[model samples]
Target: MEAMMEQREGVALFTICRPEKRNAVNFVVMEALEGALSEAEADERVKIFAITGAGDEAFCSGGDLHEFGPLRGAEAKQMLTRMGEVLYRLLTFPKPTAALVNGAAMGGGCELATACDFRFVKEGSRIGFIQG
Candidate 1:
């Protein structure tokens, strides 16, 4: 599973499950995030949405370069558009949203964190937007 969702005490916690990849967001992760976000948004019992990563090493490294580096024209555009929509949804989520950055959050991961209304970072955590 690329992602996991757990609801506890009216809080919806969504975790990126690719610890080996530093919880990078590939297409699979994006899709899983979308589904999880939709479900959380629709559930009236979910008072807050929180996003995090599986391991302590990183909250998210960024987009999976190996998976997305070879796109040409239209394919890249489509993917970007889709990701933009997802981010927009996150940014404008009806309920409160938060990014719990336990570690590094680079590139798209930084964007994800920023989309949330609140961000809670742990000690020694790093976050930035570095386009390559």
Candidate 2:
């Protein structure tokens, strides 16, 4: 699994578990995030949703380029649409949402952070949108 979810004190924490890949978002990660959000939404006790990365090196660097670079035409569009829908869900989640940016947040990572209602960046962390 590329994502992990835990609940505590009415808060749901969703962590992207791919620090080795700079916590990049792949299809699996995207699906996991959607599932986690769905679970949290259905849980009445979950008053807030928080997202982060697993390691100190990066909160989320962006989409996994190596895995997605070969996609073209309809395939690429579909993937983008999928991710956009997931982010849209996060953006419109009923409860408050936060992005705990522990480190670098680039590209899609930045988009994810922006979708949240709140964003907390750690010291020395970097965030930007860089796509080619």
Candidate 3:
């Protein structure tokens, strides 16, 4: 599986479980995130959400370009639009969201973190607003 969900400390944690690719977000991963977000939001047990990566290397690398290879301009744009919609829903979720960046967060991953109400990163990790 590419993701996992857990609850603790009055918060629900959604982890990007792919550490080999630095926890990159593919379409499937995005869907999993959407589901996790929806499930937690609907469950009254969840008051806050903390998104993070599974390993020490990265919070997320970005979109999985390898998953959508060689798409033309229009195709890429449409796909990106879909991803945007997912993020928009997450951003507008009623409860507070946090990105517990244990490591690097880049591109769409960084946007995911920024969309949250709080961003708590480890001391040595880097955060970037890159897109690729």
Candidate 4:
């Protein structure tokens, strides 16, 4: 799974599971994130939503350019639009949210962290926007 969801102690923890790619965002990760958010929103037991990466090396590196590099004009546009909608929903979510920044968070990863209500960054972790 590109992402996984675990609910415990009233928190729904959404983890991006592509450590090999530095937890980079791809279509699969996007879908999984969206689904996790939706599920947590509807589940009354979940009072908090938290997001993080699989490994300690990176919270997230941003988009997987290697996976998306082949897209043409319309395809790229559609993907970007969808991701934007997902972020918008997260930003407006009713419940409190948290971003667990375990390591490096760059580009879109930085955006994702900001979307949450609060961020808990690990010691020595770095967060920056490198989007161009």
Ranking by lDDT: 2, 1, 4, 3
Which is superior by TM-score, 1 or 3? 1
Ordered from best to worst TM-score, the candidate numbers read: 2, 1, 4, 3
- Give lDDT tens digits, candidate 1, residues 1-132: 889899999999999999999999999989988998999989999999999999999999988888888976999999899999999999999999999999999999999999999999999999997757
So what's the TM-score on candidate 3?
A: 0.92
Off by over 4 Å in 2: none
Q: What's the lDDT for residue 72 in model 4?
A: 82
How many steric clashes between backbone atoms does each model show?
A: 0, 0, 0, 0
Candidate 4 residue lDDT tens string, 1-132: 889999999999999999999999999999999999999999999999999999999999988999787888999999889889988888988999999999999988998999999999999999997647
Query: Candidate 2: what lDDT?
Result: 0.95
Clashing residue pairs in candidate 3, if any?
Answer: none
> Which regions in candidate 1 have their CA more than 4 angstroms from the true location?
none
Cα miss at 15, model 3 (Å)?
0.2
List the lowest-lDDT window of 10 residues for candidate 2: 123-132
Report the C-alpha lDDT of model 3 over 2-116, residue by residue, as the tens digit: 9999999779999999999999998889999999988998989899988999899999988988986666799988878988998898889899999999898988888888989
- Candidate 3 yields a Cα-based lDDT of 0.89
The prediction achieving the highest lDDT against the true structure is: 2
TM-scores for the candidates:
0.96, 0.97, 0.92, 0.96
